[model samples]
Target: MAHFDSNFIMSRILLTDEPTQIGCVYLEAGGIIGFHQALSAQLLLVVHGPASVRCDSESEVCVSVGDAVFWEKGEWHETKTETGLMAIVIESEALNPTKYMPVKLIKD
Candidate 1:
């Protein structure tokens, strides 16, 4: 079973096996870092301040402290800071092959 606890500091917790990883990330004020395409679907859960997300051809969505968003694989996307945002990002397997492997979030 996978588990996590972010009551102390901003952190991340990775769960599940290959091709199906769940993550929980915490961010402080104006903290953001993600512009790469994923090999799988991503589900984001906001736990703190307001967060903004932009997708190809789609208007940015401002998620409140208790909102969630779903992103498809291979869809170029970027997240920005608005108000100290904290979230949980989960990824699923890719539909096609020959893409980034390890099927995991951890790159080695």
Candidate 2:
């Protein structure tokens, strides 16, 4: 078992490669994380701030602090930031979440 910390701020905690092949996310603040189609189901634990997730033609949902959201795989979604957003993403086949919790998730 390994512990990974956020390089950006000290508000986030992470657990990698537990249930699935990937890790789970715990956000401490709010920020913008790009958009893309997921290959796994993302378990979003919003400890603070509000997050807006939009995929395809689906309406955006405002997730506040203490809210837990699950984003399935193969859906195009983008993180909307107004006042910084903190949310975790679950990698489907990811054996570790901490190792994948970076800007690398957002493909360019």
Candidate 3:
């Protein structure tokens, strides 16, 4: 519970035993993070701007602020943007977003 006047919110805890890393990435206009296989399970959370992401041979998907993309270990993926963007990336062998995040269904 949060106090009405506190302006503070608590987040659910995530536990991991394997090595974990978190990073903030910025992409300029026309920037791209080329395709590569994920070394571990990974999650990319967009915090600003918009970008496109692709996994394996799948078509690119546009993502904007507040969108999140996850990739399993060994999955090939790529990220790019035309108008720049900023995102938080989390990597770990033990990452499991399904435990804390609701699945977002996409129709082909």
Candidate 4:
């Protein structure tokens, strides 16, 4: 957790395994997580008040409690909030080929 001012605090929790990852981030009002890209398919869940997101190929979107967003692997995205925001983030697969076996599309 980090305290930025009298009214703002940021916190995060993260976990991962070979196939997936789960994380939660708490961002206070006006806080930003910055522009970035996901290495694998991702699911972002907004579990608290208003947050906004910007992703490549789309316009910015405002999200609230119970809202969810999905991002394809390697898609650039960013997140911010004008009010306190709690987001649950999940990513699927290892992403890095060096870390896992090759995927087989079919069985002979």
- Score each candidate by Cα lDDT: 0.63, 0.57, 0.89, 0.72
Query: Candidate 3 versus the native: TM-score?
Result: 0.89
- Winning candidate number (TM-score): 3
Candidate 2 lDDT: 0.57
Candidate 3 clash pair list: none
* Candidate 2 Cα RMSD after full superposition onto the native fold (Å): 10.9
How do the residues 1-108 of candidate 3 rate in per-residue lDDT, one tens digit apiece? 556667666544257887899999999999999999999999998999999999988888999998889999999999999999999999998889888887784535
Q: Supply candidate 2's per-residue lDDT for 72.
A: 62
Ranking of predictions according to lDDT? 3, 4, 1, 2
Write down the worst ten-residue block by lDDT for model 2. 99-108
RMSD of each: 10.6, 10.9, 2.0, 12.7
| Backbone clashes in model 1, listed as residue pairs | none
The digit string of per-residue lDDT tens for model 2 on 1-108 reads: 134743553433345445554344443345555678776766666755777766666777776786655556787777665766555554554433345344223221
Please give the lDDT score at residue 87 for candidate 3.
96
Q: Estimate the TM-score of every prediction.
A: 0.62, 0.54, 0.89, 0.66
- Candidate 3 segments whose C-alpha is farther than 4 A from its true place: 8-13, 105-107
Residue 37 of model 1, lDDT score:
74
Clashing pairs in 4: none
Range of the 10 consecutive residues with the lowest summed lDDT in candidate 3: 5-14
Task: Order candidates by TM-score, high to low.
Answer: 3, 4, 1, 2
Candidate 2 ranges with C-alpha deviation above 4 Å? 1-30, 93-108
